[model samples]
Target: MSLWKNRNFLLLLGGQGVSEFGSSITYVAMPLVALTVLDASSFEVGVLTAMSSLAFLLISLPAGVVVDRSARKKLMLWSNVGRAALVGVVPLLAALDALEMVHLYVVAFFVGVLTVLFEIAYQSFVPSVVTKDQLVDANGKLSTTQSLSVVLGPPLGGGLVALMGATRVMAVDALSYLVSVVSLLLLPMREEPPAKTAGFSWDAVRRETAEGLSFVFGHPVLRKVVACTATSNFFGAMYFALEMVFFVKELNAGPLLIGLAISAGGAGGVLGGLTARRVSTRVGSARMIWVSVLGLGWTGVLVPLAGPGWGFALIAVGLFGFSLSAVLYNTAQVSYRQAVCPPELLGRVNASVRWVVWGTLPVGALVAGWLATSLGVRETLLVAGAGGWLAGLWVYFSPIRGMRDVPTTEPVTA
Candidate 1:
């Protein structure tokens, strides 16, 4: 069955696309808002970012439990509404000429909390709307949309910010969340059954969390996938933390060049996401994942070497996007995980895996910051690139490399 033939999936995708594009806008607008309008110090900008991520770390597990016990659609709707309300404050404050860095930080924190809830619900809901066979395709399609938003979002966001001013541009983001809420309400899927243990208890939650962790760690394929992904994220975070410094100092790039280089990667990601399914079918999922890792790892290697010219940097960034392995890896891994996990365990399992995978980001960011301060920007990037490449070896040497096809039945425990 063609992916487009599924009405509910289309709605979900459309709604999410709107919301993600808005998020893309905020990605640019927020820093600019803090930096230019509020005159936020570098430390304050860093604090705002750290606070937002801290919300994700703090809220993900509890949000998983709530998602498991609630109607997934309702969770999505309310989360969108909540995010809309949180983001709206920026514009309101701007209108009053009362916007402050503290206000932005608080709003960012609130939005971050809502995003965590939405993401937990969103990941858990995918399996319910699409068939097992369609899982990879669905994820691929979603990735494509997300990549498109990344490609379009920043520039569109910059334009909106430029035309309407930063505070007013946030209204576009708020509207997207409202659109998402409406689309979610229109989805036709049956409500998921509540968790068997409905009442919240610390012991029960802890046990559920433990079970999710065990499932991921206990499975041979999942274990290797998580290890490789987590390591890659750590090194990738380092590269990102140092990217601006590398661009300014090493490449002697200006804002226009930086924007062009970043946009090229987004374009590559869109192309890669679109081709994920075809590539997986031709090369096999496991091999495709290995290829993606290598591609991504090499992007890290190539960036620092791209030199001072805008042309060289643009090519390097585009190749960097093209080389991303996560689009395929996620498409395959999400399908594999959803198929193997029991229905009741889906939320926690998804959350557990994310907690481990994304949990490394903050540490990586901090380490990169420290390293950049001590080792210099170019040297830091080189370390990140080399480390990312070495991390790919986890997939290369593991049993995951031998799995030629996704299993149709429950994965056997090793």
Candidate 2:
């Protein structure tokens, strides 16, 4: 049962592939725009990054309610359109010399808002397009596409930035959304609607949000995973928020070099993803989680040690390790979550988990910015590295560490 043969799944794969590629380009372009064009400091970049995740914290639960109650295909389609239009505004304003830090922040926030809905809908939608047996393979393939984007995007984005400017590179991302929109339009699958609610009210919102929280907190393994990931994201934000600063300001690397290094590191993710299921199956998915998480954190320390030409190479290795470990851990965990959770609760459960895990990103970004300003780039990153390693401790002590694999027979919540 190769997913490639599944016409509907292929459409999803194609759409996400193109969209992720565009988004990856912006990953490099956005920071460069702020740094090279606007002269934004590390703190500002941190704030910008944090703002992007703030919507996850604010709207995730509500978005989950919508996803559970509404047609996911429609939700995903309109969200794509919304994000496409929003991203286009950046380049347009930049060309007119109207772009500012505030514009970037606002755009990031609103885009985040749209992204939350799209994410919840997409995750909920995927299961309907494929059989239960295909979840791991499906998720792995998706991760592989993301890795490919990481490999292709940074280099492409760097070239675009080198030629025109970082601000102009966003147009490509805008177009990528349309590609996704078309794929959605092509899909012939019908989503099953949830039971109709009596009416939307503040009480319903609270109850739904609470139910998601209760499920996660009640589950031992999921709770640990959420805590560990949230903690890591908090510290990882500090490291990532100022990563470009370290490369350009400290290492004296150019945009092309930055892209190359990122791409080089992405190669590890590609490898990790291609082999994710194989490795997880061999080693046991549960054990692999802690192993990968610890490896991600410890190896991340190598980046701060980077100095110059050769130093960039060292940093690339660190990035490679981080990406590799992340792919392995994500493939295992995401598949586990998808498999064990009841389909009926998918939207709320996923949204609630994201709200807790991704919610920490804003705080992390803000803290990273403040730390970089007050302590120093290397010092802040060093602290982040330490914090990253510490995140695994929560899961290490959890029931998950003793398990072998994710079970499909019963909900983990039980």
TM per candidate: 0.90, 0.97
Worst 10-residue lDDT window, candidate 2? 405-414
Residue pairs with colliding backbones in model 2 are none
Model 1 global lDDT (CA atoms, 0 to 1): 0.74
Off by over 4 Å in 1: 39-44, 242-258, 306-319, 411-414
Tell me the tens digit of each residue's lDDT in model 2 across 195-305.
Answer: 636588889988887887788788878889889888988888888898899888988889888998899768878888898878878877667788788757588888898
lDDT by residue for model 1 (175-218), tens: 99999999998887787468654568988788777777788888
Best by TM-score: 2
Error of 2 at 275 (Å): 0.7
**lDDT, residue 262, model 2:** 91
How many Å off is the CA of 90 in candidate 1?
Answer: 2.1
Candidate lDDT values, in order: 0.74, 0.86
